[model samples]
Target chain A: MATAADITHIACVVYPGYDALDLAGALEPLTMLSSNVPFQFYVVGPSLEPVTTKVNASVVKTVSPSFGQSIAPTHTYDNPPEKIDFLIIPGGMMFLDPIERQQPTIDFVKKTYPKVKYVLSVCTGSVILAQAGILDGKRATSNKACWAWVMENCPNVNWVAKARWVVDGNVWTTSGVAAGMDGMFAWITQIYGEAAATVAANVIEYDRHTDASWDPFSDAWRTTDPDHGKSVQPKFTE
Target chain B: MATAADITHIACVVYPGYDALDLAGALEPLTMLSSNVPFQFYVVGPSLEPVTTKVNASVVKTVSPSFGQSIAPTHTYDNPPEKIDFLIIPGGMMFLDPIERQQPTIDFVKKTYPKVKYVLSVCTGSVILAQAGILDGKRATSNKACWAWVMENCPNVNWVAKARWVVDGNVWTTSGVAAGMDGMFAWITQIYGEAAATVAANVIEYDRHTDASWDPFSDAWRTTDPDHGKSVQPKFTE
Candidate 1:
């Protein structure tokens, strides 16, 4: 029976080509703690219409790029919550989409960051934060598969290539899609308490990569001169 | 340019209180292969309206039970796809939800299972399959937190207690939410070949639990007599 004031409004910015797992993985832990903490989660997009998650490629002759999931946004950029305590940003094939199509979300991130108590980004989502100048000097990370492109796009940002997730002040940035789950769990432990984080992880039966500095994929992917979608190399034999 | 015949129609059943991670974790890998396979994903519910993902608790005075995420169903049980190659069933608080509210989905599963080339159940999703009689005399696994309740409800099915995921013929059942990711990757490896799965896992930066029998959470939760939502035990320190 908590009032609206007691609720921590956590909003996630989404758009077409945003990764579904990146958004779902990070937010899943927060939803687990909703009993004690009235975490009212909101998915904000450019509009109220359903936005497609990232697809590997366009379907032949289809009017729209069909994805595994289409997430419905509760709030539009024009109608976000009064205040967002925690802001999550997930990246996907956003780089491929025209910058004009991405500008609204980038603007929203910049506008929302100052008011947000904590900010987190998953995968190439740090690129959006970087584009918004939030990661200008902050330590962050992104998907190693698109490492060069993320770096090339956001030159002002300080990117860490070898960490699973990086926490600097109130901002947390995870390496890639599934790594967001680990980062969110870590955030839950720090913010909600250790017990809450433990429960969240255990309920999902998630075997987390506990060591932040020990990211193997970063090492595995770096062995080759990376291409756009060249995700794994021969070194990933394990 | 894949024709209609070249596509593999994957249909996921979503109802009220379905786990977001359970659905997302299992489907992300399949979406990664959309380029080569044209794996079209279809979310089917009782109706065309939006379906809420599982929430930890209800908000006071709210008309509708709000969750972190809501999935929009492209198809309904009344109007399903002509053919479905893969059928994914994800679980959450469906146990608490009324059987009548769940009956439609259970009925849909029973009707669709025979035609589906491959069937997957994540977490307590096995319970639905069990309810639908699809798991009759077949070996399966489910979320360890609700082990007793699931076992009691589905006495006929041979429930495996120590598997991250179990595969018997064309049917697959995962231990819990995140465990579905491992199960899906394994399915991809077996069905699509090893190279595709390797790329999918690496791209998401998911370090998989390769061994099917290597489930630590099963042992972690088994230590305590399971409560409804008793997710983790003290032995989960690692």
Candidate 2:
């Protein structure tokens, strides 16, 4: 049994305009694993300040006085822990705006990926990892709703069209927001055992999709082959 | 189509030691309804301070800095908006510690429920509503893991065993944390028709369980009759 000494440190990267479900979907299941396996988590960002999501100001303003206040990072990218066992990145529509706008997040992922045991991305979060060259020569998937944009931006990645999640070596990528929960459940199964994963799912009453190849969205969205699409010129600035 | 003039204000009652997914699971689906229905949200609590969850502190402390920060509430119970269209209450293990411990939360729901169009509870959140007398004579459900405790505390309410969610008039209650997403999806369907709910579910990539009667967990957990069990004396103090 893993003890406190064997605790793994997992980092969840957050940013302004990130999807709240993308973060919560993954964290909820992962946190439930704590009772079985000793592990810790870190919400890392550019700074320790609060980051807002894209949930529209007027709707969330009453609850979150400023922007759509989502989460406040515990550690700045500049001062992360010396060792991180796992890293999770969540997605949002903001990534589709301008690739150059994600430089800070890109830089942080690039600097930290080598030190982590596993790197995971949810929805458009794969875009940041792709921009950092972390998903190069790796199998990955992103939010199917924005599949064309992801394929256009990161041509080097083996982007799977019909997949709930894709795992290549130490990298894990998932489709859309809620899919992250399924990916996290699968990841927990990989780390611990199926029993541990089942317990976690039961705790949250989540009917997890265990099969990575199971994705009905690709058919729903009619995602085409990456090669057949007219690729938008990569606009990411190093 | 609902315009800005027809916007509904939904207040999510939050507290310290609340379950993070209980809030997020419901909010994620409901927030997606905003673009279609023109609705707003408010995270109301005792104060505007950061509230933590049951997620192990060691895991989140590095990311949140203090008290394993989860979310910061927008409005206080003492000063909420003039009118609220809906109310949501999320549940956690803390509620099981002592029913009286949740006096403040119960009071808030009781005071605000009459003005809202609907009241929703996720996981053990049903306990709070039940304690508040909002669920009196109303059919409801709660987190299956804590089924016995919830049944014991809120015997006055008609508790259903096999249910993904229950809707008695305008009050909605769901079993467990992730079940809240299903409940919210159903609630959206009630407000804006199935088409709008489908769009919201598609956006989040959520395969919503539409049937309120579809609950497999009750069979798995071996839940018995709510009336069959010897009721524990209500511990909640007025």
Tens-digit per-residue lDDT, B65-98, candidate 2: 2223367677889998677877889997653366
The residue ranges of model 1 lying beyond 4 angstroms of the native Cα positions read A1-7, A54-64, A223-238, B1-7, B54-65, B223-238
Q: Can you tell me the CAPRI class of model 2?
A: acceptable
Native contacts recovered by model 1: 0.45
Error of 1 at A224 (Å): 10
Scanning candidate 2 chain A in windows of ten residues, the lowest lDDT window is A229-238
- Residue-wise lDDT of candidate 2 within A106-161, one digit each (tens)? 99999999877788888899999999999898888988766777887899999888
Considering every candidate listed, which one attains the maximal lDDT? Answer: 1
TM-score of only chain B in every candidate structure? 0.86, 0.85
- Top model number, DockQ: 1
Which portions of model 2 show Cα errors greater than 4 Å? A1-7, A55-69, A225-238, B1-7, B55-69, B225-238
Question: Candidate 2's interface RMSD, please?
Answer: 8.6
lDDT score at residue B34, model 1, on the 0-100 scale:
66
